[model samples]
Target: MFGVLTERQAQQEERLLDEEEKIPPTSIYNLELLRECKSSRRRWKFFCVLVFILTFTSVAQLYLSLSEFKNQLLITTLNRVKSAELTKDIDIIPIHSHNDEWRRLPLYDALRVGAQSVEADVWYFDSDPDTIFVGHNKVFLSSKWNLDDMYLNPLFSLIGQNNIAKRFEDENVSTRRNGIFYNNLHQTLYLYLDIKSNSEKTMAALEDKLSPFINNEYLSYYNSETDEFVEGPVTVIITGNYPYDYIVSKSTRYFFIDAPLFKFKNDEELAKYNHSCIALASSASLYQLTESRRALAGVAGLSEAQVDTISSYIDIAHNNDIKVRIWETPSWPVRTRNEVWKQLITLGVDTLNVDDLYAATTFF
Candidate 1:
């Protein structure tokens, strides 16, 4: 009786059997899950590749931008040499690095940013006349960091690097030797020497040290007999207790005097020197130039009187064919510093005397 089923019970049992067969087998269920996983893997791969492409593009843009200085127009021709850090597309700017020796990387730092002028305070201790020590004062000067070690040798190396190809190239490619910059071959780099010790001994030591550059025709020089300035890769400008008479008196000299802006009473006074010698740069302390006892600008920016005085001085300098640079400018209060810098630039100052290269770069 248990084995035998009633007709109605047999029909119900058959319906249950049909429903069980419609359900997928265990193997088929596992196959469905595998298909879903494959689709998910494809999507994940696409997303990763998209992210990688975007990230790579962003990094490339930042690399080119970080290496460029925005102070001047971009020079794109030198992209061939962009592989090197210093050989990036560097645009020459009229920024002067004041107290450049105080920087972490003296000549190289200024050059990387395309600073047109660099300052070095040279102190000659009589005890060792062989070396011209570089510092604001002898107390903190390092013997290892002399004029030759700090600037001369490194500069010559750069000059050599720039000129290597010229030696092998055809004469039509370039008739003259190149400068330290691969981007700007003709631009002159000013080396400002602030004489901290006796002018006589320091100049003598400097002449001896510069012999290598001089012999190589790498220095901008003034020939007294010819009364013409021969432009070169580097121009030496002497300031601060620098024997002005000595530079002017010499028949032939490699360096020029940093014309004291205060010494000239007016344009007429500037005219006399302009015709007589090559004073490529003129510098004055803000106090000495404007007769201000302190930083009168004081966040408000320079006064009307100060602005007028400065404008006149810059006009005199330009008319006389000299690049005027004003130092002791206000440093505090970002707004004030920027304001003064803008005003000076508007007034036609040739170069900004700056201790902060990064800050100054923004203005140009």
Candidate 2:
């Protein structure tokens, strides 16, 4: 019986040993939990590294884009400055101030604003040949507004005061200075005298008034015998009822005639008028040239046909070394006037006839 009891106790002890084997120790469970924590920490570290790389790449790309934009802006500003410098060095475009006598200051005002040419309408009063009145019509005539007082005297004063001859000599060795502007020593000032009365008497009066300038070699003249043109400070061009025959017949003349643009149908006709010898320029009505193109008016600017016609006239005149001027351009609605001015400039018009001197000077 004692032996049976011992065996039973041994069996109970064995069962206890088997239960211990099935269940894990506290230290072993702790080791498994620590392994899982280490794996989670490694994954977290990898995720942080990926995030850092992406953020670094985005920042670097943004910096490069900003740097490129900065470079482009700098280049644009530099180009604009260079363009302005180039424009400043170019010559002032020739401008013709129409009806200069009607202005508030006459010739003086036009010269002050850099107008290379000015027009004066002269009416010869046979009653007094000594006095050449400057006016658009007889009604606006005044004794104080004579050609000598309004134009000649002031010109003489300005030329002497500015020492134009000396300035020109110092600057240009070969070219002669003509215009009243001191800064520009190469341009010639065109004095357009439109005669409104008897051509014979008017010519005499004009010669008398211009004798001082002609004598001083300040007036441009043509010597028929020598076939040479003597350029001077001022070029006198006669238009509007000028005696063409009388002018062409002269052996030596101090004044040039403005040839009628419409009469010159071809090169032969242009030469027939002695355009190269006697005429300084040709004048035509701009309205007449654009009449056919009126249908295309403001929409497409000037038509191809109109451009060709205008260009042909310009070509003929330029071929003979003659400048072409078109007067009576549309003046109202400033935009249209500017457009016309732009077109004329683009077409290479030598002299622009403008009422608004300031606008024309600034437009370029």
Candidate 3:
């Protein structure tokens, strides 16, 4: 019985050993899988950290670039404002050069001295109405010295070179035209067209010559139908035998008439003429003020009666928004001319019509 029990015990022990071997192999396979999973997880974590670091670096670089651009824009704006403030103001009073065509350089010399207004006496040939001439008399007329050749063409060229339209656009200004002087921005150069020939025929010729400027909007013109004056670089005022009845009848006029100051006795008469639309300025001879003063004093020596007469005319013109200009004032004798100019300035004359541009500009 003892021998049988020992054999049975030995068989049971063998079965237990087999079971232990199978369990250990299975456990080792599970351990290997677990080790592979841990290795994969560590690699994935390292990859994620690298991606995070790269993303942080890219965002930081983008922020720095944007900040630099913002600073540059601010500096450019400040410099522009500073440059504008440094430019000086051109403060010149209105000075008109009478018989400006008679000067050595018609418009150029007057412009150099800062003469805002200039006059040209123009005549059209009776035989050939198309031909216009610029001169004090017909004897001095030349085909080469025509209005367009002398004034309009050169003016157009200057305007093109200056780029006036762009400058005005930048300034946010639309009303007044740009002046010839570079420093003077908003002042329009007044061009007095003194018609010396037949009023009707000469005007037609003048229109033809001025058509280019009018078309390009370089010349100011009054639109009677709209009752609006279109401002431009040059303002043309017609004088010397201008047809008043014909001028008043027009629906639109490129030329403004020089109304006779003597005709209007009071503001009521001046208003009735509609001087604002038809005329820019009313002009008269200094002799027209009083007969006694004309015979004895001229413009230099004026009696209180003459002074009152002249003052009344100026007042009447001013009431109608029309500027006053007195022609045929004393020109000889420098002292007398200076005295007359002083008197005229004191009287608040809108423009001093002087033959000597230098004297006029230098006076004040």
Best by lDDT: 1
lDDT of 1 by residue, 236-316 (tens): 999888876677777877988888887666656676467655588898888887878444757778888898988888877
- The positional error of residue 128 in candidate 2, measured at the CA in angstroms, is 2.0
Please report the candidate that would top TM-score against the real structure.
1
Task: Write the residue-wise lDDT of candidate 2 on 105-136 in tens digits.
Answer: 67755765677789999988778878889999
Comparing 1 with 3 on lDDT, the higher-scoring candidate is: 1
Taking the tens digit of each residue's C-alpha lDDT, what string does model 3 give over 1-364? 9999999999999999988787878797899999999999999999999999999999988997777566545433332332123223434557888998777666665665777788999888777666678999788788857787667766666654444455554657554445455676556788999998889888878777888777767788788777898777788899997877767777877888887888888556666565446878878888766543242455455556667778988987888888899888777667777877887887878999988877787777
Per model, state how many residue pairs clash. Answer: 1, 0, 0
lDDT of 2: 0.75
Global lDDT of each model? 0.80, 0.75, 0.74
Once model 2 is optimally superposed onto the true structure by TM-score, how far is the C-alpha of residue 240 displaced, in angstroms?
0.7
Residue 160 accuracy (lDDT) in model 3: 49
Q: Candidates sorted by lDDT, descending order?
A: 1, 2, 3
Residue-level error in angstroms, candidate 1, position 282: 0.5
